[model samples]
Target: MDEMLSVRQLMKTYGKGCPACLDLTGPDHGRNMCPVCGTIVACADVSLDVYPGEVLGIVGESGSGKSTLVKTLYFDEEPTAGEFYLRSYEDGVPNLYDLSSRKKRWVRNHQMGMVYQNPHLGLRLDHSAGGNIAEKLLMAGNYHVGSIRERAVQLLEKTDIPITRMDDLPRYFSGGMQQRVQISKAMANNPPLLLLDEVTTGLDVSVQANVLDLIREIQRELGVSMIVVSHDFSVIRMLTNRTIVMKNGRIVEQGLTDQIMEDPQHAYTQLLINSLL
Candidate 1:
């Protein structure tokens, strides 16, 4: 499979005691949670590949660095030291963690997008649903604002959000609806990679099923490679071909979704699978 994003020997740290901190100036020392002292070293020396047209599910308990790993992959957090590559077009490649602020803005505008755990954290709560979706594109300089409302409406409809509510504030929407709005915002630029962090975290099982189905359908339509961070094995099985099991901030086992589910090698993996039974 072709690689869309690759992380090799990547390391990140925070705090004053890390080896990385010795080698380089630490992050603002006043802040205890710096990305330079091995704060998330559970991901140290980690390497993985996300392929085109595939969904890679990352499952782990909270505080295991699953969020941090996803963020770093998308350049949301800079690695203390390592080599990585994001396959962009003819330009050959781009180091996601090393782009200049100006260049990084370009990638953030179009090729990369994230669906956060908290919809409010990623959306403009003050804006209407359509405006929230269109705002991201406008920031990306997507000039067709004339048609953006139309585009936003299509997304609202596709995500099962009623077209009648396009002009409503996010605060007025239910949790599930707000999540759908986040999905629509993420797809605004038709990004190649989407980082879905517990996208269905707060929804009911009934609504989770619907939202997951919607995500799968959209990924198929867009040919987007998704890295979904969720602890739900059923969601992983339903949405991803491959599985990565994280524990204490590191990948303990990874393989085909079914294989890992049916015949896990690691004890922790077995525990996870058993919980489902």
Candidate 2:
């Protein structure tokens, strides 16, 4: 399969060079902070390729740059230095980072979708569940009221949200249901890329399971490529065919899901697997 997305030498730092910045580029610098200059290195030379219809897992504890990577790809944050490419953009001929603001906005609306860990970031709580999905459709240039509503109903039903409650505001829904609504909205445009960051967090175990199952179903049905970001090994194991273990803004280990789970080469990856067992 062709690579759908490619990111190379990505870096996000809060401050300029300090003498310690160079030294803080190893596994030991998992904190990603420079003790001398107080620079926060959110990502450091990170590179990865995501293929069509593949669920690529990125696992790392908090402050390990997992969120930063997603935010950068979604244009929620900018990378200091990197090359970002998507097969859909100009036939993968141009580096997305070089695109103008207007063009980037077009890519965001038509080609990529992101479901943040916090539902508020992805949803308009005051809007009806159907309305939230309509907003995305509208942004993607769908203006027909009847078609938008029809699409909304289909998505809501797919996510297991009652079509009857389509008019209800997401705020009235439970956290898990709110997440389902968020997913429905994110998929409204049928973007090729989906970015999910700790999506199952802050929910009851059963609700988390349901949410994960819903995500799996959506991916399978839509065949969308996904970048699943989480610290949870189980989440990665269940959803991803291939996985990358990140630490200190760098990938410590990467391989097939089963191989990484069975024989983690990095001490950090081993520790993570052991804790889960």
Candidate 3:
């Protein structure tokens, strides 16, 4: 299958006058008040492709640039080098990182979607489930109130979140249930790709299984390619067929999940696996 998204030679850094930044020739004063010095890349020199209907899992210790990679791929921050691309009807694979602000917003809202670890972060705490879902559809230009209500209900139903809970705020739901609503919202319009940053984090371990199962069900139903970043080996083992292990802002190992789990070549990866054991 053709590449749905591509990232090449990607680099990012925080702080100033750090030795790591010397290689990238970073600014003496870092931009955005980031703590990284010199050019310590949060995520760097990264190249990866997400194919249609595949779920690629990224795993690493905290600050390994797993989520940062997801953010860059989603075009959240300007990369110091390399580029990001998105396929569009008129543009014939336009560069995402280079897009104008207005164009980028349009792409983010209509064509792309994201799911986060915490549902409260992903959802509007003040709004009910109906409102949370509707706001997303509304942002995507879905107007009709009746249509929004109906779609919201349908999505909740599909995600196995009960209809009775529609009017309830996100705070009332359990972590697993909240995650279900979030999945519903992320899959609301059926985007071609999803950027999931630790989708099951913060939830109870028992609940994580259910949420992962829900995500798998929705993926099968929508057939959208996904880039899921997580630290939990169980998440990678249960949800993804392929896994990419990142360490210190670089990809240390990537391949079939089972093989990497059983026979890790990278010492860091082996250490991570052992830690989980």
Best by lDDT: 2
**Candidate 2's residue-wise lDDT over 236-258, tens digit each?**
99999999998888888999999
TM-score of 3: 0.89
lDDT per residue (tens digit) for residues 1-277 in model 3? 2677666788776545454353543222322223444445676677887777888889998878888888766667666767776554244366677778887777777777788776766888778988889988988889999999999999999888889999999888888888888888877777888888998777777787787888888788778888889998878888787899987677878999899999999888898899888
Q: What is the Cα-based lDDT of residue 70 in candidate 1?
A: 82
TM-score of 2: 0.97
lDDT of 1 by residue, 123-158 (tens): 988899999999888977877967887889888888
lDDT assessment of candidate 1: 0.79
Q: How much is the lDDT of residue 11 in candidate 3?
A: 77
TM-score, cand. 1: 0.89
Give the poorly placed runs of model 3, Cα more than 4 Å off: 16-40, 88-92
lDDT of each: 0.79, 0.91, 0.78
Candidate with top TM-score is 2
TM-score of each: 0.89, 0.97, 0.89
Model 2 spans > 4 angstroms off: none
lDDT of 3 at 266: 84
